[model samples]
Target: LPAPILRLAAVLITSGLLILGCDENQQGFLLTNRPIVYLGDISYVVYLAHWPTIILWKSVSDSTSLSIFGIFNCLLITFKISIVAHHTIEQFFIRSKVKAVSIVVSLIYGLLAIGLMFNVPATVNTSVASRAASVDVAAAIEWNERVSHNAYRQHRPCKECLDDPEGQRMRGGYTGKGDRFECIWKPDKANGSVKILIIGNSVAHLAISILKPVIEENFPQVELVRLYSMPACRPTEVVQYVCPPYHKALPKQVQAMKPDITMIMYDDAILFITSSKIGQERKILKKTFNKYKV
Candidate 1:
């Protein structure tokens, strides 16, 4: 396959993994069977060894001079080495030999490793402090309170609203009337800039705060026009749920705003099924992109 096709496939696979990881049920791609459970059994060893194996190979090899063939050869060599190490060394010697004596020995070594991993600053840098300071925490709490009050103001009945009505209403328009939540935008009055439309789901909405400062600093000539939905919805969902009666529909709303660029970030994992279904979605997305010249 082409490099672009391979890149797309990698992206889709990564998205699938993210979805599986985020899923509370831990079913992964296999909803009906226990494939993830089976995989999870050996995942710890794979996780522990794969990174070091890759790093070791890359460290020895001339990565800059590696061609596609060379890369493939490296991968094959790494796979063989990993299989041998896992089956012969890790599984047989470390995991399979779990007698009472071995268990005690393992516990002593395990505690040492854990202590080294956590305590040694030069090894892991465990002393790193959170950027979210006491003031930031207070601000976040204040924001939460505002959102709660806002929810109650909008007559939202969720427990969050009861707790902090003001904050909920201000930040997220969590009115109990519907599933949709309106985004709050505060445009800079001094600098009149062209509106840039932001459309998609929660992820896209989350990007707004991060993007806001960047846009204001870098692209000061542009204003933001946001059209965001909840976690479960996407662009397609916008067409279905948002259109009728609401003056500001989804894509139409975006188009009418006449944004220079439409940035869309959605969770494709919501539509994930089996690997076959994922492949089909990729095909469909490619076709749709081509049809619209997206």
Candidate 2:
């Protein structure tokens, strides 16, 4: 179902529940029973207090698990806190005749709650400050400066090569083409280059960065080639929003380049597309491998 349809269904269901709640004949029903009514009255306070109480208790007590006694005590504490909050905070606002005074008080309480929510976490875990103190800022700054110049080695973005699937810009301007998203790294000293095509998103780009030195050390003649891979553009013919055109273009590009080795490293999009037929994935893989063959 589409998102709009799902949203409409949710709205209809909630409206139905509201209609039922308003019906006097449904007073004896589970939702309208005395205990349920009282719970509903205090539910707002429970929503505000329960998780924070549990988290604060866990941090202070240094215990992840609660025994039966501990569980009972936690519930008791929560109940007591909720009851106090319901009477003092909730009822005070509800019963107060002065609307402006109530709004001001509520806003003040809300601001206090927001302040505590952010500040309490930092205060609770003092080690966050210690971790910040431990970071070597000078070393980090120096490393950043060194790698900042070579940042282009990660990924190239070019507007001119968008329409041309066969177009590629080789490193060192070996091929006089648009300096586009496609990148081909060739060895300087080697006479011949073994093209290794990488197909995927940022994972493929980062892999190239990490593997470049290792490949250069072991096989100086190897070249690392990367195509313009959008984040979710898996090599397979998966039905995704940003996929169809890129998917169709990929095999043609692979066939044209005829790289000696092809490396396909998709992002987390694979998890979503895994529901697709395994045979379909295999079929795409076989086709891509066939194109890689010289």
Top candidate (lDDT): 2
Local error of candidate 2 at 24, Å?
Answer: 17
lDDT by residue for model 1 (1-294), tens = 455687999799868867876887765345554755545445556566666655665445412123355456666665666666667666666655458558777899998898877776554542343533445767787767644423423432222212323323433433333444434353563264444444544445444555554445545444444434443345533222332322234534544444445555554322211222234433443343333211
* Residue-wise C-alpha lDDT for candidate 2, range 1-294, written one tens digit per residue: 334675899799768867878887874595647776798799889888888887777555433334345456777889899999998978877877798667878999999899798897667577675677877978987767533424533433322112332343222212212221355555555444455566764445444554454554555555444444444344553323334455555666666666666667644322111213233433443454334211
The superposed Cα distance between candidate 1 and the true structure at residue 82, in angstroms, equals 31
In model 1, what lDDT does residue 196 have?
Answer: 46
What TM-score would every model get versus the actual structure?
0.30, 0.41
- Evaluated against the true structure, the overall lDDT of model 2 is 0.55
**Which portions of model 1 miss their true places by more than 4 Å?**
1-177, 184-186, 189-192, 236-248, 268-294
Index of the highest-TM-score prediction = 2
Which stretch of 10 consecutive residues in model 2 shows the poorest summed lDDT? 171-180
Candidate 2, residue 52: Cα displacement in angstroms equals 18
